[model samples]
Target chain A: MMAEQISIFIENKEGRLAEVTAILRDAQVNIRALSLADTTDFGVLRLIVNDNDKATAALKKEGFTVGKTQVLAVEVTDEPGGLNKVLDPLCEQDVNVEYMYAFANPQCKNAIMIFRFDDIDKAKEILAQKDIKVIDGKELSGL
Target chain B: MPIFDIDFETMPREGLEAIQLRRLQTTLERIYATVPFYKETYDKAGIKPTDIKSLDDLRRLPFTTKQDLRDNYPYAMFAVPMEQIVRIHASSGTTGKPTVVGYTKRDIATWAELMARSMSAAGATNGDIIHNAWGYGLFTGGLGAHYGAERLGASVIPVSGGNTKRQITIMQDFKPTILCGTPSYILHLAEVADEMGVDFKDLYFKSGIFGAEPWTEEMRQELEAKCNLKAVDIYGLSEVIGPGVSIECVEEQKGLHVFEDHFIVEVVDPDTLEPLPYGEPGELVFTSITKEAFPVIRYRTKDITSLNPTPCTCGRTHVRMNKPTGRTDDMLIIRGVNVFPSQIESVLMETREVAPHYQLEVDRIDNLDTLTVKVEIDETSFSDDIKGLQAMEAKLSHDIKEHLGVSARVALVEPKTIERSQGKAVRVIDNRKL
Candidate 1:
């Protein structure tokens, strides 16, 4: 299932990450998972927060450019071949994984991995056919 | 036409010309006798001060340029001795030198009086509190306006430039009636005020006398709506006695009325050097007639503008000049500080991280002029990490501000992102039409 994520454009400067985190903290929004993609000039910070509306409103009020995106949240086995199991089907189905990150789920027993795919619907269909556990936006953000 | 001759400012055109001719002759004689540069130039042209019997004959004199001022250097252009000079102001010159101008006691008095008259024309009264943000020191706008405001018996707050937040607080606290600064800086102030949740409509500002940089009617409307004041244009150059050379009346913000009593103004074709008739746009030239210390004769200002001889509705009979549209040179005035592209080039060339290729982009962002130096990333300096590139950008930006006294955002573009001409890459991309 698809989970919603937020991306923010931040200048490559000191304490920007800390500043962003401080805003989220003051807004009382909890960050569930995050990934940062950086280039020479700037960085795009992706965050899975408990409240997208609150986080976006707070960050935007502080003049941060915020954007919303859709990413898949997959629950893989906590074992060593956990990620390999999901990748094996995705690779066989000719799916492209643009980027991905993982975190231990406090809500469930298995580990949760977030993925950004070129063709998200194709990847979702492939995972659904394989009977892999895919967490929805509400459940993934809560974890 | 019932013309008011009660004041020196609104004298009839014929009467003004007669006074101008007498002053011009006097200035010519003084400069010829005092400054060797003028004496030599006048002698080289085989002309003498007495030869300029009429204003028409004054056109026969050779034009003085910024290069001429540079040739004289520190004080050779001073018509009076050092003992008589009271103040000196300078504008940016080529290759790091400055175009120096000195004012004697009388020259200073003249400047103050003219400035006061200019303020009066802008609807500023002695009761008004003027928040002067034009940077003081060598820049003539600050002190020139200060003395003028004082002369007019106005409460002058010499809050010279920068400290944006503090300026906002001062505005809210003092409730100044008049704002005197470059339009760009005033725009910046309004923006800062908005950020601080202080509205100008809630403040006591009634008029803004903006000068030192070219601004548009659009900017005028923007500032008026934002600051709740009438925005009027004031024109001046350091060589021509600073910020009191001309000003627009608040009642009729059509054109700036040139104070022809002090300076004999002229317009000439920049390319051909032929005098342009009134109502035709050309390079502005001035002969500072009443100036005692540094009286200039037909000084080419290189500012593109036209002259309007028609009388203004404000009852000032002085000929009005169109707001300066552009400069004939590559000089860029950022926040009333003049910056040339070559100056930026020297700063960028000093940095080993960036290649020699660069372009300067100037845009008015939120009413403040912003300079962006787009430097080509050299292959050797190209790094995979964002921190290093950002550091390089910071360094370049710092160096530019340190050297040029103007803030700039340094951007490292791709190797060949900047379009290159057949000969050299295009240097400046100015988006501010004003």
Candidate 2:
């Protein structure tokens, strides 16, 4: 079970982030979860959107350097150390998390955490054997 | 100031033209007799050596271009036999094969004499120590300046290029009066010296003869202020005769005086190839009248500058050529390295994931030339992963540097972002001039 994340290459200049948001707003695309990794010269804006194809076309039409990456969404108990419980098993299995972000599902009591693992298949298999629920792209896109 | 070779340097216009005509006739006869390329060229033009009666008739001959030299390759253009050739030098072609030049014993002597004249005109004397920093080897800038300094009886340090710190150390210890190199490199040395806490002004440098690349007057001001010396512009090319074809007399910084007795200088319309009168800027073309090994007739230098036919206050009656303002070709001299846009385009074409659409942005950052290549990334290879994109950029940059010998900052822009023209694509956005 994997989710597609759209990443845009953004130059580190004034009002650049605003420009990206404005483009998305004009295209009527909703960004679900977003994260930015930046260096001195430029930054990469990683985004999970409601519609991948539409968002990619709209952004590409507006001349943005965009790419797609695969990530995993897992449901965790909304309790103390919920992230720790899910991370401990992957860490024990020697799986590395490149990056991660969280969002609470309104319909469920559990919290949905998105993870970009070094090896998505291996991490999914390990988490599956440990009885942790992995949210697929179809379900995550709906949220 | 002592005028070097008073007879030729101070010769009247009529006397200079008389010597030029005689030398031009001999040079034409030798090239037409020895080099088959010149024979075919002259035959195609329906002209003979005897047809060049006066200096003005020299224009009837076809202009020799750098492409002609490259097409001939190694020694096809040399008028003298291998036994008579003593030295060989070349200009870095950057595109393909280098344009080669050869020198016989007399040709070497002529080069030394012209260089000596250039040195003396720039206020260098026998007691002065010459620090030659223009590169050596196949490039004529180094050895050309070296022999001239020696010919002038000046102590030569032959400090070719690079090793910035050591060059400064030698400069401080040797206390040289004459510094010979490109103006940009001399400024670079000044910065390095300042960083080392060595005051360049305290050095015994009295004057500098800088050339091998075109530099602005502002650069001369910077070099003189930083190094505490008079920065004189010296012009030359390997195809004509390296580093001493012409030089600016220190007494008058107006324009460089071409050694008319040895070289016939002309400024012509780059498009029509029609000769322009004095004081009108055009493509500079040179004809080597006295060279023995490679006597070129109407060699197109591709440099854009005018000739000052007026008399100079320095007493040198030789026709003065203005410092070359630009080039007729798309050649860019970045930090003394010759870089062509076509060369950069070839590098980009070979690399994967980069589109053919690209623009080269050249800027002068902190008194140094900086090249930035803005290339478009193909949509198929575009990825959201930061590390993968960075790896691609690094690979392209490394490949470009390997091919061009000069480092460039590779900037990946979105496809169709670079303005596409219906006509010829404007490849170079030179911000350096601004």
lDDT of 1 by residue, B330-425 (tens): 898988999888888877777766788899999988877888898876446654335566888899999988877889998876556578789778
Error of 2 at A134 (Å): 2.2
Models 1 onward score TM values of 0.74, 0.91
The stretch of ten residues in a row with the least summed lDDT in candidate 1 chain B is B1-10
Report the lDDT tens digits of candidate 2 across residue range B179-285. Answer: 99877778888888999999977899999999877888888888989999998999998899988999999999879999999999999999999999999999999
Clashing pairs in 2: A67-B384
Task: State, as a TM-score between 0 and 1, how close model 2 is to the true structure.
Answer: 0.91
Evaluate model 1: give its lDDT: 0.86
Candidate 2 chain B has its poorest 10 consecutive residues by lDDT at: B90-99
Candidate 1 docking DockQ: 0.04
